[model samples]
Target chain A: MFNLFLKTMYDKRIFIIAWSIGLAFFAYLMLLFFPAFKDSGLDQLLATLPPELKALKGMIGDISALSTPSGYLAGQFFDIRMPMFISVFSVILAVGLSVKDEEEGYIRTLLALPLSRIKLLFGKLIAIVVICVATTIATVSGLYLGALSVNVNLDWTVVSNLSLVMLLLSICMTTLVYCIGLSTGKRGITMGLGILVGAGSFLLTTFAKSVDWLQPYEKVSLFHYFPAVDIVKNGISIWDVVVLVGITILSILLTIILFRRRDVR
Target chain B: MTIQPVLEVDAVTKYYGSFLAIQDIHFMISKGEVVGLVGLNGAGKTTIINLIMGFLRTSAGKIRLFGEPVLPENAHKMHPKVGFATGDMSLFTNLTGRQYFAFLKRAYKLKDDKKLGELCKQFNPDMDKKIKTLSRGNKQKIALISAFMSGPELVILDEPSSGLDPFMQQKFLELINHEGAKGTTIFMSSHYLKEVADVCSRVLFIRDGKLVKDVSRAELESSHGKAVHITTSRAIRPPAQSSLLGHQKTANGYEMSFIFKDSPIKLQQWLCSISYMLDFTIEDHDLESAFSDLYSKDKSEAKNV
Candidate 1:
């Protein structure tokens, strides 16, 4: 399993490095712009703006959320952009890990070894999960570094909990991509569904916040359960954690079952 | 006690949706048997091979390797005993040949690098070069080396010599012979008749997704005839009592070719009865002629039907 994991990650070094560094840089850059806004009294100026415009800026809940370093990081990054970034990264890795091998005829050679198919897939799955964790950590650490550089010490408790939420969201989205890719063995389908679901969830979340009638539809979006603002403003919800974790486990189980049943093309 | 065969494909059938690729195929290879699968393009040879390798799910029937039923989920258990190479397989283009071998070694959990090093030297592949840069023949050599380096009990090769030069082809034959001598069962497919006849103990001929012929090497050597090619001074029709296989016009008036599956003296007597031949040459019937004869006969039979 470890060998398979190493081999799967072998060709993905560039992708992992680029996404991790990009996420970290985005965090650093976003945090770098925060103090200037705080010093210029733009937070109060922003508070006076119309609610719809605020929702457009991805600030739907508390106006105070953007005033602090933790709230600013979660509200600006984790709520919208971070989930999008992580979902894209996760989908690429997961889909590539599950389907690309069979497409490239690598699975035949691997299956010819003494390892079982389930074990081989699990190896690739574990590698993808590890990559997701690394990118998440990089983004969170960048947030921490940017916060400390400005002498605005972040609450580790809230930061860790928020990171966990992001990671769970990533797991749920990636496993969905994996299941689709494994079942269909078509990169196009996996990618199309991945983007539609990954980015679409965010779209639904924002639309739900902006429109009163669409608010009920937010429950269907995976992003709804993460509640980045809720984590930042109040505390992490155990029920939300349960929902995200449950979705991930269910997706994985379904992926494995469907993969075993489908023919390897 | 009767020893179990190395491979037993019993009543195996495969269908791709509504199109039947191979149907009711049955064959067995005992230990140390070198069997050659031969056919024209799209003759279901590759389909059968993929079925045995568990790359495709059998629409019906079963394949047993070393007495163990082979299925997609349990296919890996047979991997340690089976080494397979195919022209259709795609290698990782990004990795150097050496890196790819190292990766396989790790997957197989084998510690010996000496076999890989020896194969690299024997095949003379640029080990450090990326696979995408190598020529097709060199990539083929890489695949062959990977298949044989492990000294597996059963080696499956599909058109293994397709991209090889004459020298490498000879080496590959020698390798197959060496493996057979070591009691390793080898199943291969090829277009080269003489090579298959030289190394394989038995040959399986498939046509239109059916096993049409299965003959042993001894049977082929004794019963296969010689081809007689005769050129006439004029475009004269065959004699009213002639049993020639085929007659076609050449630069010369006409040339007639046919297999004489009888004593050379009888063939000479039959030739003596023909008075108009200007030139004639009798060549020993090889696997190629015998195979072509099978197809020609099949076509005539199909037309008659």
Candidate 2:
């Protein structure tokens, strides 16, 4: 099991490095623009904006709060850019863990090894968790360093809480994609469904803020549990953590059962 | 003393969503036996291999390896004692042959690389190059090396020689023979009947998801009988005393051909009775023709039904 885990991680070393640098750089770059927003009368500009632009505010959460560092970071980076980037990255990595191998006929070689299906899947799941945690750390480190360079007095505990929730969100999305990939064993189908779920969750959660009818279904979306702005202001919610963790554990269990029974292509 | 069979598949049947891939298939391979499974395309050859390896579950019945039931949960436990290879199997193309073997070594947890070193020497694949960079035959060599390097007691191969050239195929056959001589139980499926005939002690014939024939190598050779072709000056009725199969006439009824199953002396006596006979030739039947006969017979039988 350890060997399989190490091999899986080694195989994705390049991907890990690229995503870490890319996310960290993006986070740092986004923070560098925070100084400009801090002094600019953006709050007044936002208040005078057309009423129709309220939907954009709904998506970004509390546009008037953009004068503060946490609000600016959440609105510009965490709420949209970071989640979307991490979602895409997680889906790709999750699919490669199983469905891509099955599609390319390499799963047979892996299955022929002296490792049980449960161990094999758990090994891959561990690799995904480690990668997600590493990338989350990189993003937080970038934000921390960027905050220091710009002389912003950011609260470390709030940032850590937000990063933790973000990591959980990434894990939840990745495990869901991994489950779908193992169930279908087709790259295209798995990828299409993964994107649908990720994008749909974001859209549902975003629109639920303003649409009265969608408000009731907001909790159904995985993104609703992320609550980047809320986490930045109020710290992590235990219920949100429990929901994401529950989904991840359920997804892993479902993957193991399906993978053990399905025929290898 | 009683010897246990290395592999036993009892009444195994598999279906893919109401489409029966294989049905009621049963066979056992004892130790030191080199068995060949011969079938045409989509004849459930790979399906059986998958079942035996526990890659696919049996819809009904059971398969046993080394006396324990074969299931996905326990398949890995037996993998250390089994070596498997197939032509269509894809390798991690990103890794060089050396790297791939190193990974396998870690997976299998073998104490040393002595067996792997020997197999590399024998197959002589380009170990330094990436698998994707190698030719089809070279990749096949890597697969073969992977299978045998573990020194498994039971080696299961599916179209194991599909990508090799003639010389390389001969080398593979020699390797199979060498392993068979060393008490390795080998079950291989192939479209190449001559290769099967050369190394296998027993042959299993499958057609349309059914095992049509199972015979020993000597039985297959003798039961195929002699193929005779004759051209005579005058047309004559084939003798009833000679048990001929697939008798056919051509060349304006002057040429006749068929498989003769009777004694050669009896055939000679019958041939001597044909006064107008001009020429005749008799040759031992080959495995290819025998395979054709089995499948053709199945087709005719299906048509009758």
Best by DockQ: 2
Candidate 1 structure quality by residue, lDDT tens digits, A1-265:
9987887677778888988888888887878877875566656876888876766554443344567877777777678777777667767777777678678887767776777878877887787788789888988878877877777878888889898888888877887788788777888988888888877787888777667788878888888888887897788898898988888788778877766655676
Task: Give the Cα error of residue B88 in candidate 2, in Å.
Answer: 2.4
Give the per-residue lDDT of model 1 (tens digit) for B9-100.
99998998899999899999999999999888888998888888877789988899999988877778898888889875577777898888
Chain B TM-score of candidate 2 stands at 0.86
Q: Is the docking of candidate 2 incorrect, acceptable, medium or high quality?
A: medium
Model 1 misplacement above 4 A: A39-64, B222-224, B228-258, B263-265, B274-285, B296-298, B301-305
Which candidate number has the best TM-score? 2
What CAPRI-style quality would you assign to candidate 1? medium
Q: How does chain A of every candidate compare to the true chain A by TM-score?
A: 0.91, 0.94
Question: Across residues B1-305, which tens digit of lDDT does each residue of candidate 2 receive?
Answer: 87888899899999998999999999999999999999999999999999889888899989999998998767888899999999866888888999999889988888899989888888899999988999999999999988898899999999999999988898999999999999999999998888898999999988899988888988766655677778887777666533344334566457766667778788888888888887889887666776776677542342100
As a whole number from 0 to 100, the lDDT of residue B293 in candidate 1 is: 72
Q: The CA-based lDDT of model 2 is what?
A: 0.84
Error (Å) of candidate 2 at residue B236 is: 8.4
Candidate 2 lands at a TM-score of 0.92
